[model samples]
Target: MRRDQRTGDHRHSLPAQAPGPGNLPLELTAFVGRTAELAALTAALETGRLVTVTGVGGVGKSRLAVRAAAAAAARGGAWLVELSAVRDPDLVEHAVADALRLTDHTHRTPRKVLVDHLAGREVLLVLDGFEHLVEACASLAGDLLHRCPGLRVLAAGRRPLDTGGERIFPLAPLPAPDAAALFADRAAAGLAGFVLDEGNEADVAELCRRLDGIPLAIELAAGRLRALSPAQLLSRLDDRFALLTGTRRDVPPRHQTLRTAIGWSHELCTAEERLLWARLSVFCGPFDLDAVEYICTGDGLRADDVLDVLSELLAQSVVTREEGPTGVRYRMLDTVRAYGADWLEATGDAARMRRRHRDWYMGLATWCELDWFSPRQARVAELVDVELPNLRGALEYCLTEPDETHLGQYLAGSLWFYWVGCGRLAEGRHWLDRALELDGDHDDSRLKALWVLGYVAVLQGDTAAALAALQECKDEAERTGSAIATAYAVHRTGCLALLTDDVERAETLLRSALDQYHELGELNSNVLMGQVELAMALAFRGEIADAVVLCEDVRQVCEDHGERWTLAYALYVLGFAAWTRGEPATARELVMRCLALDHAFHDLLGTVLAIELLALFTAVEGDPAEAAVLQGAASRIWPSVGLPLFGSGNFGRPHALCEARAREQLGDARYEDCLAVGARLTPDAAVSRALRASSGGKAKTRRLPLHEGRAGDGLKQGELRPGQRA
Candidate 1:
């Protein structure tokens, strides 16, 4: 929400001011020292168009403008329209209408009604705190500025309203001397016995400077004088920054603390506004109006009224509006949101609000899971990008609450799309572990979670964990007679077996899973996983033609379903098959395509696998330096998932071949170092053997010949080699 200070015509409705002597609103009280600011505001108002006062929070922009507007009241009736109360950008015009007391029910559009009411009104409209409603404010301000020749708009906000012909008066902090004087004045007013002396002047000056010369912060610090002497307060300031707002017994309690300063604006809210603010605290990031209406306002509150309540909150400074890439969004300051969260907890509705939050995220994730396999995969990825933080919050909430443990498992299971397709394998594994630890009786939910855990584990090269989890899930799914679960478990088990070079068992399990997927008409990424495993098994059996065909089929299905992650895996298989068949150029092209897509999606595992394969391609081309660089890159990305060279057993042999060539080029010392590094990574017997064998010039190839068995043979000689092509 960076501020664009070029436009300033848009204005928010101001807070109501009490009428005072000479029929003017309460003249800015004890307005300590803003002579230059007042002069600038006055100069902007003289043109009678639109003048916006902009500054950071607590800078006295609102207070100074109130005085300036009161002074201008002699020339025209100055009406203060506070927009901090308005939360919905769509209701900006309605807030103005309310501020003006325009009783026109006939006009449906608030903008039109406002225009009709103030078409010729000769009055100065003081719009205060309009940073949130820039767009709507701009439109309304433009309309009013065009229609009302005698109307003048004075705005005060954190940032300028970027409307055409809008003059902006940037309000800086009060000067040091003036800020010190004002602090002393406010302190003396609160504490009759207070006195400013040379002993504490330097500390007090530093305090004012640290407070950024912001009037509210100074006033808040000055209020602390009620309890402690200036010297004592200065000494304790470092420990309790919030204690700067000293208690004022006589002033309205709402003005007692900096929290209260913001809360006063909150207390002025209508009941609906207050409730909405409390509910909105659940969100961690900016949310759109539709999300607000869906998640916050409902049941007891009218959905349509959400707009009004949002407007009220915005005007009261409880919520700030922001313009996002999609549209206008609203958010609360972290401090303000923390305060609202406290209120939410006090209301005994925390559980319900959390439920609503979880439900919204659950529904969103479920939709993405289904949509990820469609032509809208790219669009679904974008949607997931926006909702990711909220989804994480929901997952966290579900995992923490005892009663919500099952829900957490369900959420993790449902987000298989995000985990597998988006390359969130590491995060998926982390949450899956937490969900399983809950020990809930959600066997079905646990089954899905287990499968996902196994999926991530397999990708990370944790064969034991992958096998244990998938086998457990398979047993449970079969016991429960859950066909879909069984199919998924079987498919993933095949993947694990393939990673371990058990091509015969891998092919058997994959074929079984494929049969079940076809029987159940489940043609999603789960089914794609089965086909990929089958292709890998075929490649391992040396049936390169069959492997190539299966890879092609999977790629087409992935394209048709818009499953880029699965497509990336299919490309890896296709490229490897081509590389083994001596088509280095084709292998390079396919591997590069997979690399490009994986990088775009931030799929760490996919990126590593693609890089490793590219390194093999470079080795095949006799370019060991380039091959080593790609291998190094893969090694760097490998540890992130803690499963170095996890799921690509078929590719591992080729990678080992490439590393040998690279070592030969770099000399025995560097090659031995690389092998030493690889040996210390993890206890994979195959990798250990590969490293040992490659160290010697006459390396013993442990590859089991696939031609020793039939087309659908199982594991033989503890290794699976490329079988004879059909």
Candidate 2:
């Protein structure tokens, strides 16, 4: 439900220009037989800006809306957001933002970013399969329509959103003729050489009628033709409907009919396949073969047997397959998943399956964290990207279950890199805060969560919260004798000090943390980054030689370890030191590399700092015009990162020097013009410009190696300067 919980990793699709490249899913099969409904829905859209296509489960509302939206795409740029997988009402905005391919670097609420982006655009937004999120959808649609005069919404759900200006276009089941035609089409696909004629017309029509003309039900019934004859299927349908006597009386007949159809399909599946279906329902979104194997196996079904049964489920249309850039993943329709979940509960294996689901994703997070500091960093990020929804589901189960709070804390704390490196600081804080609030003793997991919370709060410029969390983390670490937790506590405390310009204390804490890391053999990205922070602190204290040497050591270790996130920070300090040492070209090279890496991970803070440094280097290299432009670019990104210039001391000096020199050289009016140009650059374009030399100058070809040596050797923990408290 939250943006992070969506099925696919939402890399921005290219913006639609004139609707030539909208993201409507390509219809796999012929959009069988909904001529009248499609026409009516399209007509309704033309008159009403907000149209709700309401129907029961398996009634084809989603298909009808998409068909209408595709037709309107040419004129209004139609986009579809599939909301059945969304479970959290609060994540509705993120769902829409993902579907629109909106990736923002700002800390603004996703809703605000969405509204501001769509304010002037004329587009048709399709909210499909949104019954569970109706209220959230209604609120979002109302706000968007009120803000963007040209925006239109076409929502498909079991009921209406009922927002102002909304018109309910109730969709009935397919007419008999249409339903029969759909049955024959799918039957032909499932059973080769099968033709509907005098041989079976009556039986097909009777089967469709029994299924209540529901498109999904009809399709399921037809798919049985692969083995069962039409006469056999019709007989089976009659018995299935008759067995629905105990169904809810408050529900409509069509609802009962759909459930009976799904039940019949379930009954037809082999026992192993049925078990797999029930287990697969554990996933809230698409899942890969490996996940199915890991979570859906046991209790007489071996892990390797999953693929065979899974393929059978696919053949029977119990599960849907989608192929994306990552590869093939399977999903169940909400209706089918609901049926499976019911059976799963009935079987009394739901709790066991949920725990398996949680364990699998927790292992995945652990693997990703391990790989994050290796050459597999980018691929690891992509894999983690695809698993976010499952991760969210796991975390949800952990936090809500009385016995699983500690697991939730561990899971949230373990994903610090994914949250911080991937532009999800606010969400990270949300999970960490909730995890910490649960009733539990201060353990290692709580210690980890506390420090991660501190790190996130510091990045958000919430100094009070940051200090509070870190103090608790430090206290818990000492109490529990957790060396790793103590190291993280000391490292993040140093990070906070560095951000506040307490350079002396920062260096002392960082050195203590580094010594602890060495003792603990902590060689992940965090420890490497602790070294980077130490380098920055040393630089701020005017120990340029030692700072450069330390960063060089970090860069070598990162390169050797195949890490980029920590390496980027090392490059930043090394670049700044290079600039101060009168090596303009070396500074540019180092800073540009830093900018590229930061952009790759979407690290706003790193990206902004690098931009500001490049601007200062450019000013001294004599292109005052370009310096002003880069400064403007950095300014636009500062609010997104909070407390832009690190702290107002040596870390702030380069920005000040660049701004004064650019203003003196370019004068006021032209400087403003250049600044405007820089501010206009998108996040991607800003990185591109930083990589490209300004004023047509050739970028420096030769690279200068940063100092490579042991990190501040022979300096014991007790050797800290007087009054320097870590």
Candidate 3:
């Protein structure tokens, strides 16, 4: 997520895109004048397993690594893990796993999951903004290189990881001519119909040369074209330089140079723009107009005129617009933001602005959590996805600031949907654990986070941890006299029971939890999922008629409310019922629908379970080879998810039945051969094969529920792993 800013030379932030192969961010701005650097970096990647691109801040080291990775790392897809916003060393692997789109259901650490995933894949890993986490990055990089023969590490930072066999690719500033060309490019974009010509050519060259040929400095200078001629800009730069002279002789000359460039930009902004810029520093990630208006305006800067000021900043290249997951958004270069932060600190307003920033994200998480159950679920997902960096930033602020643990707990609990539903369970657990470690006066917030911790721990197959958290939550609820918290505790306790193969206890608890949800008039993704879990319990207990009735009722409710996540699980129950009644075609169609939703959401638990059932249906349809292959693919997926079939007699029954039948039909050797072949396919590839073959050999992503926003969990419906019996 590095914005490819000047590494380690200044403050840094993140970059975002609308998802890509390995979720590599799209370079928002056109990469200017890096042909030679790109070539050399690519060649270095060709020769070494680890290449650390090092340079001063503003030297475009991150940008070069990204370009090189895109060019040469196409075979295994380029995965970029942004580290500037991540403060916890333990979360680094979590960030990498998330970027690589891995969703493991096991209690294993992210490092183990990453190593297992990378062992045979020819993938490129880009580690951006690693200077702050040098030791962690060095350890991870070395371990990954030693273990994964097909892995290449392209790291961008101010300093090298210094791992053994590391190739440090030191990046220098742009050459004088290239600097001027970059300025010309940025200037022309700022002023329509503008171009570089003989007039003012020398002035532009002098500006680039005087600015040390740094791309960021050149671009900032170019942003002045609307107000100053090239000569006039150079004149101001000279004045700003004279005013900024300091006695810090030990500072790197390049640091001083880059500082002067950013300082000059700050000095030129109007008073309102300056105030806005300083306030804007609180945001370390991409922001949209609504956010700017909400968080950056109102104190001396009027909300009505925020857009005009924003447009002026955009014109000045202090802020640049790009496509975000939600829509059009703007971002400030990290170096510029650092300057603003310094000014904000000097103005004695940093605390206030930070509080404001936290409040905005807190509200966002709360609203998104509530909306996650409604028809606006997809919109909520997209918004949270886009705002994750800032959200993480805000979470960091809450956890690190004194007397803010309660708020941190609340925020962590509020993001349960994003953590569980949006495929960030490990990270969610990380934050929740941290937030819960310190005592807060607010029991409600603490209890909320406690239940959420139990929920995630259950899905991760950590039954002991799950029991501890749920027990604490229930005890705290009764002590506080909170019925809502008590109900949530009861619900997830049922989930734990469901996952541990106690279907009778699970059924009773789930049914009781559903009645509690009804009595309290609670309705969200969580509430709907409680109902679906109840149905799963009934199906596991061999009460097919009741399971059908319950699931169908849940499905109708899902359709009415535009809730697809819970609906997927409801369909899974009906699909199981359909299969039990000897309707193979109907069962396949229903489970395929379920798989489509799970795959779309990166819900690995649901995905593997669906694939398991699909294998059984395929077997019934007389394709034992494909069925065995599907089972093989499921085997490949299970480690990432958790224990295969959750180690539940009930949950494992479907898979065991499929394996036995497929083996009987194909014979042991033939079945084993097909299983090996299917196991070779990646998770996405296996799902693709399953989807196409299920659809009569037709590609079906578009036609599936995904295009309309599909993701669901039937086994506690993501509140718990998929544990229902076939």
Candidate 4:
């Protein structure tokens, strides 16, 4: 489905999207002067299974690919995976998975997720900014093209992926007319009353020609309109272009042109602007003013002058203003940021700026974690989602530097809310696993990371990993005398017990953990979640009344603090209790609320549980056919999440009962047919159908038609829902 390109946070709303219909950002500015290129690309992709638009930096490859994919993939849709910010080769698959928005709860490799999701869909996979990950991309694309018959790979980068059967479309500089038109358009935006009129058309053409017709170059040169006219700009550029290239054999001529253009723009910037530009290169993704102020200030760039200097950069087109869910932010194009990075390195300030960047994001993560415990929980999710790239950069910095392992552990441990609550379990595992491999100086930080890893593993149904991590954390915490670490270790061990269906042990351990938390005066999402888990254990042990009472208390606290993550779990337990007591109406309302919160937070496990529960409700409502379909939808999602019903008798009973009833109402063949219908719906479509089915649209009416494909972007994958455990 189409999302507003302006609100970038909307793109980050889900954990990444499950493969669905197309999602291409609506171009903010008009796509100009690529008519032939667009036509050629469209034709290439139409006939070729793997087409790469290769060009030097700033030659409009990405832009042209986006335009072509949008047009060519009209039937199945296109999914854009941006790899510029992702540095690790191993994460190339994860980056693609995130782009496709696969919400798998299991520890399955990202390659498996992509192959499984793409095998059936006729979708164009657009991999932009992937030059840095060429080998990985080549491997992945080769595998996908071999397995997914309907899939097409459209990649944009500086070089070819060099895979078997790959088609390389080397992009050249725009012709004179198109380049001049691009300048006229960007120049008009930068300077008032600027147009391609008889007065300056020739000069504009000459300027674009000299700039080598590179889009980024043209845009940057156009920014000079505030200080110089087209004629004046041409006069100044003649001198600059004379020595722009001809001797650099290592770099392509187009690359040289791009570099020369950027260097000229750099030369044009004021000293403050140039310094700020170099400093700003430290950011991996779009950054807000608050972050820039915190990390980019100082270092000869006065704090108070950051705003003015940044404004000058923005005005000069060095930094472009972009909006996200959090409001206005700024971004530097990849090529420009690269140039700034080179400048930063030349100034010998690269390491310091990188450290500052890491520190700011670390601070941001800490604050967001705290905010996660308050009513600003949803807002925190938004901010984290928007800053994930930068946060990932921070985590990499800490983990890569030998002396910073402790900080890496702390950072990973601190983001438990984002990892578990926001449904980033797999990616969280990637970072935590990496952080934990090295020994940190601070045992407490490592212990915290250990417990969080255990908690995530429990959710992913990785019993061995969960048990090992938790046990080690307990042993280390006890040895180090860290009560907080011990408390979390115990708490997550209880979670592992619950997932594995050891309800009695779960109840005992969870109660102990909660006590430890209370004694330590620890009241946060984790403590409340421990309470909720205890209630689940109680519910599993047939103590429905006690479970209800405990969850009710947890709910009250969560509401008081505006906490939704723990609140969702509490609601799940309470809703199940309500259904047990035969209050179907109230049960539906409460569970629906839980589902809404879970989906909003991109909690795959929570969303799946709600869907499963609603399907059971529908079965009892005399619409066995509709109920069976919902069950099929849940079944489709369970693989991504891990084992269905968590292999727990308590959780499985409801699903079993619903299936039996549906079979009785509709014969085996009819019921199986309904299941197939539901299974065919994309993950997001199924959730949408489930939510709609749970609403006034009753089982009998079944007004909403379950379809085979996705309508738009949605949460389609699954993991263990909060109340889904035994």
Candidate 5:
């Protein structure tokens, strides 16, 4: 069974309240004087498929693009994908996928997944900070436009993306009066009772003029109001930049002015604040107080001092803070981060600080992975979601640094569930493959990563890769005497066997794995899933009663642990057992319940299986038309999963039976029409329709067990698939 592409999950997870808007960041402070630019950008978006907002850093191009995107999102949907932190051209699509919140599980390329997602939608994509990845952005914009007719691209960069059909909207410095007004507003925010009046009005105006009307420089300069008067600020700028002297002709004037403004801010900071600023540059994404306390501590900076110094830096506009889902997170603008990075490099502590940063995230991933099976599973996913950029940065450091390859392997091993459960199989494989190849160590971490690789390959339907990885894991386990590694390898081998229709071998392997898990007291999501797979293999081999017992045990354990991801799989196996028992109503209820849990997590494999089972029940219950439609929908999703029915005769039986029955009863034309109808329905709508069908057309209420007891208790169940025969 295939996993749901992150694109589908991303789309489903969006806020349902306003389908009209996408994930545009809220404009916290007042948009502060971009009226003309906003208007022009909005007009450009109307007339062009691509609109490029081009300007040097700090010219307010991003602000303008955001304002326009929000407006467009109000009409349709607009998503903003920030590209400033993305350094690799190969990762451009992944960056976009992250922005779209696409957790695709398929082995398909990120670009293909994104294209499939946007193909039929009318939405706007705001690519912010595209200057670093201009060529990649241009190609992406062109391809997206070609694939999606209704798609619009809004790019913000120092230079244009240069995609064909782009309407370039050049964003210059804020006009003189607007810049002065911005500085005055910022100054008032910083220093109470400050106003733009006759006293220092000329000095403020001259300061803004000297700063080249760059919004960031104006804002940073304004932040110095508490210590420096407007006249003093102008004098400092003059002394720093030596405006009377000849400026570098090759370099841009605006860049020089902004750099001087930022440099002056840095020079004025206290020693502790300066150190904190430099150390804080290690974070590639937003960070919380706790993280800052940990990563920036030591070497003359105590944990307690970080808060006060952080506030001071915030006052200086070196870091921006916002309340996020978890808590308040702080981030530095690209220009600010660049300045701090320079200082960090100069301090010669860049390498050590980076290692510390990687270590912190590695520890974080370990903690999250250990907690993944508990009630905090959802929260863990959310936490990992927020830290992905930082995590990616850490991974890059570990993989690129020769000495850190082992740590990279360990980190990749620790994030198995996040990569597999969260629909990042291809990326997970990429990291694990690289880390494993770079180093050859026979420890617990390497073993763990090997099993994870095998599992991921199995999900991708690469039997050869799965077997090769599992064989290596098994051989190493025997050599190293690691029982946990042996058990895990055995479990994944069972999964591969089950997927390949070797039910007997699968059942044997799964039983062995379960025994080891029991002996070791290992009760995680992975172990629980092993039990569920055992039940599936039993059911496939006509051991329906025993399968029911195993599934019930798995489900009870999952409920006891408050585990949802594994419970969904248990329900699926149980639902399959119920369907074979010839109780259509019982089967329908169980399958629909399973389908709901699958859809909730965007688990595509579980979802399609439930749907296929539901179709089989409908066929036996005499609603062949609806069954045909459901079958058609499942058919469309099968390709994305890599294998249809996972090549399992047992899993394939119901789908094949349902199709045969529906086609025979409805004939070709009517069957095709009904199929098309089902195909047209979105995944959510299809699930809803299937639930309605399962409920026998009454208002639906969810129930756990389909019947009083487990299946095969003289229920006259007959096999619907290839393997089972009742």
Candidate 6:
């Protein structure tokens, strides 16, 4: 049977798991080698703000953080709010309220309740396992920090709480000496005959170091002293997992094994919670409660129950909740998730659960794609941001599943908004590539996926892949008589051609797409996207005035429709036009606005591009320092998304120009060094390629004249010019 992924309980020990926090009591003896960390944490508490203790799993972050909170109890009451049990970001504050023993009769927002409870209290709130609930934690922490000036927060998780005035202390494993001491201490306490002599001191030290001084691993290893001798255990330390078994029977059996410790937590969950836990195991990052309700709940569990179960899980220290600009979200520890997956499989429901997970994510992607065209594009972006991890998980599952490949393809194609609006070209390319490799029978899905693949490739400067995918998509769409698909494929093909400097073909393909879009009546964001492509083609072909006019038209429609993303692209085009026309100050302002919006939306690729343009504008204005700063920021962001900068057509010209200017001002040696640094920071070719090909191309094209229609089009009636669209 598969092991539970939540608390890492052994498969054999599954039956022994118990419910509630009391069942798995915190053993102070299990916590070791965090003296310095505890000291620093206590010190940070005095300084106030949200003090976050971040570390990898099994590193004893929770134990240490809790210990610190307990210690702080001497000065002021320290309320332990375990967020690991909370699955819904919306209920994050409620979970904390529950932990603090606060009852809200008025149904006030959790934030308000929390503030009221914490307002006058000179207390230390220990919010444990809050990586998943970062945003919620941030808001709560920020509020507490502001309102309850006397209150302090000690947060423990895999990452920092990210609140303003957040004092982050990254907890690493214990030093070898301390770890060895810990092992000896725990071994002596747990086993009657355990002893660490000179002969085995080196071996024990080696073992501690191997465990990376993680307290949980140390405790688990010490528990095994009942079965293995110190020397024998040292020898078997290479396969430590095999050597470590049966340390204590009275303790929760999952606590005996590293994996089982997490699994034990999974075993104790209710059926509904367990199902949600399993479904949620699919995510790769944080997710919101609405996503949980939509993706993880169904016939077995009511969608509304998601909040209740999530709240229960958070309270139980199983699921983690976070907050973002748009709302709260939840996440899981990689180790904990692995344990939940074990239980998920053991329950004989892996395949069905995975399918449900896939379906829900697919629906979400479709919804987001449709919503991207609306005036609430920014709001849609926020929603997507919170759901991205689950979507990626679903895509991954589909790509790996033989029968579900088409779903993966469809999901990838459906995320065009994320790719285009947020400048996630690199990430978009990654999913597209994997999806394309699968044998998808759905022609529409295939066509959409392929077109997106082509778009990503174009962005990454992979002309060959871009052309191949676009050609295939175009052929498939034409064969299937899919007008929408055909239009999308043709438009993207035009984008690729434009990027490669193929002006005439770009014009022809873009024009055809535009006509098709017009014929489609009430065309969605895709139609506007196609228009953007046409405008880009016009710009590249030197029709500057026409391009500007076209961009203005798109800008107005995008705004009228609440399409902030489209507006951002329009602003980008206007900035470029301004640069071409020698309007440096105007270009700077427009590009800065675009950058600000992109950054706010987590559009890393868009932010980078905006920075690149801003850098150029700054250099043109003789501000090398500002230019270098912008260039550096861009260089840092590009690599994460898998974009190649130097040889890629998408960024090559800008990169070359930036480097040359930097070199001219900063001298050849420094400039070359900066360029080298930038080169090294290239985004992953696969992800970047896809993003560039799809969204990047659309954003670029939106600047050209082809999409503007005639000068008398609706765009001219509104003053929403391309320069200030964002």
User: How many clashing pairs per prediction, in order?
Assistant: 26, 0, 6, 10, 5, 65
Tens-digit per-residue lDDT, 1-726, candidate 1: 121132211212333453431222553236666766677678778864888888767678778888788766633377777666445465466557546543221213456656655565567887877877887787788888898787788888877878888888888777887777777767777678655577777877887766667777576567556556666655555445455345556653223434544454454457787788788888866677877778886656788888988876665446767664455778876556766788889988877887888888888888888887777777677667566657877888888877888888989988877766665554566678788888877788889898888887776666777888888998999899999888888888887777666778989999999999899998886788678779878877778788888889988888766678778888988887766555556766787787777766666666667767665555444445545655655564464544466444555665666676677676777765654454333212222222233332223332223233223222222221354311
lDDT of each: 0.68, 0.80, 0.82, 0.83, 0.80, 0.65
The TM-scores of all predictions, comma-separated, are 0.59, 0.85, 0.91, 0.93, 0.87, 0.56
Error of 2 at 557 (Å): 1.0
Candidate 6 yields a Cα-based lDDT of: 0.65
lDDT of 4 at 409: 96
- Write model 3 residue lDDT over 113-150, tens digit each, in one string: 89999998888899998888999999998998899999
**Model 3, which residues run further than 4 Å from truth?**
1-35, 698-726
Predicted candidate 6 versus true structure: per-residue lDDT over 446-496, tens digit per residue: 888988888777665667878888889888888889988787778888877
lDDT, model 5, position 336 = 88
Best by the lDDT measure: 4
lDDT-better candidate, 1 vs 5? 5
- RMSD to the hidden true structure, all candidates: 22.3, 8.1, 6.8, 7.1, 7.4, 18.3
- Model 6: lDDT of residue 178: 68
For residues 1-726, could you state the per-residue lDDT of candidate 5 as single tens digits? 111231111111112222454787655555566666777788888888898988889899887787788766634488889998887677889888777756555667778978987887788899999788988989988999999888999999998877688888888898876787778767887899997888997898899988889999999999998888999998888787774224677878777778788887888889999999999999988898988888888888999899999999998889988876777899999988988999999999899899889988998999998888888887887788789889889989988986777788788888998877766776788778887887745387788889999998999898998899899999999998999999999999999999898888998999899999999999899998898898888777778788889879878887887788888778777777766664555666677788887777666677888898888767666577888878878876665566888777677877766776677777889999989888776566778888887777832323322233223221123435426532
After superposition of all CA atoms, the RMSD between model 4 and the true structure is 7.1
Order of the predicted models by lDDT, top scorer first: 4, 3, 5, 2, 1, 6
